[model samples]
Target: MGLFEDLSRFLETRLDEFLKANPHLELWGLEDQLRGQEQDAIRLLGDLKRREKQLEDSILATAQDIQRWHSRIQQAQAANRIDLVKAAQEREATLLRQGNQYWGQLKGVKDQIMQTRTLQKDIHDRRRELKAKIAETQAQRTAQRTTTSWDTGWAKTSFDGFGRDPMDPLEESFQRWETEQELEELKRTMGK
Candidate 1:
């Protein structure tokens, strides 16, 4: 059909062949790899969260420092200390710049956290899908085998004790005698 469908079919065929050849081991290995990827993504998300918190703390501290400097500048101006006011203003400006940088970095870290989470989710979904596919394929193979065996009646049929003629003369005579004895017994019971 379409190119994507063709590619998908090709990949699925190869995957089936690989699975048939290695079965549980290959599937387990792939699942383990996906799990490892998920773990790594989670760890990275943790690190990003930690960095975001640190950045937030740094920004808060900077804001506090800026407020304190503003109050000091007011006090300096009230006391007519222009020199101290100017110095405080410069310090406040620097803190503001540093705070902005931290904010930018925090945003970047948050974006990375989102990306890592998405990657983890994808890995988890892929792992689940692969497991389902493996199980379905295994079940189909088992059912196919069962149908084949049952259709052939391998277990229900046997050639044991068979001969050219299944009914020998003496065996036929014996069967007839047994039938007659059963009939006589049934008749006697009815009479009683």
Candidate 2:
């Protein structure tokens, strides 16, 4: 167990360092987290809806049972059966209480459904925002890479006009001939 914990800690530390080193990965991680949260909220909403339906069914069944017991109570009274009347009235009261409890549960489930829906929406909004940021970050990184490459290319190719002359062999020959002609003209002028 100690070894496992140490390994887990090491892995976590490495992951943290890796994520810090790559910020774009962190944005993607956030987006994944938001997606997971949205999925959880959707699942909760489904469960809450199921619970609400069950509570509604329970409330309806309890109401019917209450009505049936109420009818029995009236019938017992009409028949002048006091003991049965009391029992039927108690049953009816119990059913009413049960129905109220179901209603309360139904209300709570409905509230939870609303809250889960809001949570889902919030998660979706965060994911959208993160996606936009990720897109913007990608664009900026692309532009930065392009500019860096351009600068590197220029740096590698630049001769700064003072390094080596780029003239062809023929151009060099012509330049040499022109210099000789100028020297000859200067020599002739000096002799005269």
Candidate 3:
């Protein structure tokens, strides 16, 4: 390889090693973002539930008012008081209109609550998937580190009961020669 290509490879290897030694550095921002999203989902769900309850209560009270006015109109008609009956009928009509409006609003609020709940569930599921992916990545990294350490341990062990150094000089020299030969072969193949 050219000098610049070799330098690039060296830099990349060093960066990988640095990052492997500091696993938390890469995950910090992503973890924080996930936490924030989870919190926002929880807050939104709570707000939607509260609003749904309020709308339901308001709809119930309006329905009760409409019923009360209807009974008053009936009582006035039974007493044969035309003036009182007419006033009660008018009041009942107004209350009926208000009740219909409140019912429509309640339906709209219920739809919104259902939508919000669905969104919350989606966010919750995504957060769980993200957490699982992060855990899987961590487990893979740990396995890779363990394999590397196992290889290093083998390097330190004696081969065939020989009290030689961790790295055999002859093997190192042969490896270097092989690497140079491979590079030369690559260069020749590329017509460099």
Candidate 4:
């Protein structure tokens, strides 16, 4: 068990380092976790509903038995049979206690279902937020076309790789302006 714990801790440390290095992948990881939580909450909600139904049935059965015994107690009273009346009253009280226990269990299951539903809703919201962040990350990566030196295309217009004019003045002006815009965008992203 000690060795297994060591291995688990080692793996968790490695995973954390990996996520820190690739921050964009962290969004995907969080979304995946939320999806699993959503599924788990849904499954648990189903189980709780089934249990609630069973408890309701038990309470109903016990209530009916309690009522039947109550009738017997009244009948014994009218017949002046004190012994039977006493026994029927005891049986009715026992059934009432059982019914109350079932009611308590039913209330607990209902509370769990409510909590699980809230958890499911929270996970769903987190997933939506993470998906939006992932989409923004993908768009940012796509927009960052140049990896070096901020892409000053003015030099390119004056001299191509072979020291010849690459394009006319009109085109050169447009390319230089476009390159500056891209550089500014990259700077803003880096600041964040």
Cα distance off (Å), candidate 1, residue 118: 1.5
Candidate 1, residue 191: lDDT: 100
Better of 2 and 4 by TM-score: 2
Tens-digit lDDT track of model 4 for 21-118: 87789988888888998999999999999999999999989989998999999999999999999999999988998899999999999999999999
Instruction: Give the candidate number with the greatest TM-score.
Output: 2
Provide the overall lDDT of each model, using Cα atoms, as 2-decimal numbers. Answer: 0.84, 0.85, 0.76, 0.86
Where in model 1 is the C-alpha error above 4 Å? 1-20, 144-192
Backbone clash pairs in model 3 (N, Cα, C under 3 Å; residues 3+ apart or in different chains), count: 0
Q: Which ten residues in a row have the lowest lDDT in candidate 3?
A: 153-162
Query: Could you give me the TM-score of model 4 versus the true structure?
Result: 0.69
Query: What C-alpha root-mean-square deviation, in Å, does candidate 3 show against the real structure?
Result: 15.3
lDDT tens digits by residue: candidate 1, 13-52: 9988987786765777788898899889889888888998
Task: Give the TM-score comparing model 1 with the true structure, all chains together.
Answer: 0.63
Which portions of model 3 show Cα errors greater than 4 Å?
Answer: 1-28, 145-192
Q: TM-score per candidate, in order?
A: 0.63, 0.75, 0.57, 0.69
RMSD, every candidate, angstroms: 12.5, 9.7, 15.3, 13.4
- In angstroms, give how far residue 180 of model 4 lies from its true place: 34
Ranking of predictions according to lDDT:
4, 2, 1, 3
Error of 3 at 176 (Å): 25
